[model samples]
Target: MRILIVGGGVLGTLHAWQAVERGHDVVQLESEPEARGASVRNFGLVWVGGRATGAELDTALRARVLWERIGERVPGLGFRANGSLTVVRTEAELAVAAEVAAGAEAADRGYKLLDVAETKKLNPALRGDFRSALWCERDAAVEPRVAQPALRAELARSGRYTWKPGREVRHLSATGVVDDRGERHDGDVVVFCTGAWTGGLVRELAGEPPVRKVRLQMAQTEPLGEELTTSVADGDSFRYYPAYRGPALETLEAGQPQSKVAQEHRMQLLLVQRLDGSLTIGDTHEYDQPFAFDVTEDPYEHLAEVAGALLGRPLPRIRRRWAGVYAQTTDTGRIVHRERVADNALLVTGPGGRGMTCSPAIAEDTAEELNL
Candidate 1:
């Protein structure tokens, strides 16, 4: 089978990877020279700890396995099972962590309530004043900036995968697709993994998917002198992830509301160090469209303060700051929005922030469903 995958982001590249691995030919097209969307501009967290129970968690676990296997095959991925630490400062936050650690599926999620000593042992860089932390051993990280190129290079070696950049799909058909160059690429099946791009042919074909765009602001700093063994998040992250929701979380939210700036930006502090030792930190959520043309400094200020509080030191000089947008489903219950627009054409998108964590498993499911 010849699979034509539109969009060269992680999701589409993973689809190509899956098809080519199954001994099928694949051709993927990207509008720009390479993907410049939410795919590359993310924390590269293969996060399993914060995923909601059931299907979302299951997909994250499966994708984690796939990522390990693929990362072993491609060393450039920079995959590591470093896990994560959500540090808590107050008694309310500690209660929430305890609740999550005591949940029925806590074992599956690798949830452990760690004291100050145990937390410091896992990530010695954290010298801050915190009561305890929520440890998730199943979490991991990857190099999002280079993952696609690395995967495509491996797929190219298969001799059945072709990557065509600077080409956008202008029209779709049951048999294949037509690019902006007016060239027709034929295939037995066509899968559109377009991420956050809901305009042009996507709107024409799908007619306003059950998904919306989400904007976020992030920044990276100069290399830290020391190693940050594990990814770090503050207790505020409990407000963003569904897995932490419960009576305890509800009480924490009521008692300890977010800061004025944090509430204004819908912010959460997630910090991860890159292979070069630089820390990638972010982010604040913006749901309403027509996102700001300029990135604000208040959120970054808040992030720095929170991060400094966790590490017991000031952050390194910030080198870069940017904003990105991704597609998310309106219905929070659905993992992603997958629909068949034609007999041989299917649209799979709106994995939201889970694009990095769940792409591999999502593509695997797509293959099994289409019998490709």
Candidate 2:
């Protein structure tokens, strides 16, 4: 089978990987010289512990295993099983963590309620005051910036994968697609993994998928000057992840209101260390359309304050700040929005934040479904 993959982000690259691995010839196209969407702008967290029950959780676990395997094969991925800690500072937050840690799926999720001493011992860099933390051993991280190029390089080894950049697919034809260069690339099957750019060809084919665009703010700071053994999250994260929803969570929310700025911007503090000793920290969620043209300063300030509290020191000077948009299915239960846009072409996207986490499994599923 000759597979034509559109988009050059992680999802598209992974699809190309799956197709090539299955003994199919794949030609992947990208609009930009490189992917500049949410794929590269994310924290590169293969987050698993906070996923909802059922398919969402199952997909994350499968992706985590797949990530480790691929990381071993592709050393440039910079993958590590460092895991994550959602630190709790108050009794309310601790109750929420304790409840989830003792739940039925605790073992599967690697959920353990760690004491202050245990948490500090696990991540020595955390010298701040905190009661306890929810330890998720299943969580992991990868270097997002170089992930796609690294995967593509490995796929090229198969001699069946061809990558075409600086090509914006103009139209989908019966056989394959026609690019802006007026070149026709023929293939047996076409898969559109277009990221957040759903305006032109995407809208013309799928007619507005149930997916919505999400805008987020992120920043990279100067090297922390020390190792952050594990990824860190604030207790506020519990309010955002579906897995943490319970009576205790409800109680915590009612009793402990979020800081004004955090509530206003839908913010959570997730800190991860890059391979270069720098810390990648972010994220405030802005759902409504017409997102701000520029990054807001308040969210970054809030993030710095929370991160400093967790580290017991001032945060390093921020070297860069960025904003990105990703497509997500409005339905919370579904992992992504997939549909057959044409007889020979299928459109798979809207994995949302799961794009970085579950892309491998998602691409694998696409192959199995298409019998590639």
CA lDDT, every model vs. true structure: 0.94, 0.95
Tens-digit lDDT string for candidate 1 (1-372): 899999999999999999999999999999999899999999999999999998999999999999999999999999999999999999999999999999998999999999999999989999989999999999999999999999999999999999999998999877799999999999999999999998899888889999999999999999999999999999999999989999999999898989999999999999999999999999999998789889999999999999998899999999999999999987788889999988888899999999999999999999999887
Backbone collisions counted per model? 0, 0
Ten contiguous residues with the weakest lDDT in model 2: 329-338
Give the C-alpha miss distance for residue 195 in model 1, angstroms: 0.6
lDDT (10s digit) by residue, model 2, range 106-221: 99999999999999999999999999999999999999999999999999998999999999999999989999999999999999999888878988999998999999999999
Candidate 1 lowest-lDDT run of ten: 328-337
> If scored against the real structure, what TM-score would every candidate get?
0.99, 0.99
Off by over 4 Å in 1: none
| TM-score between model 1 and native | 0.99
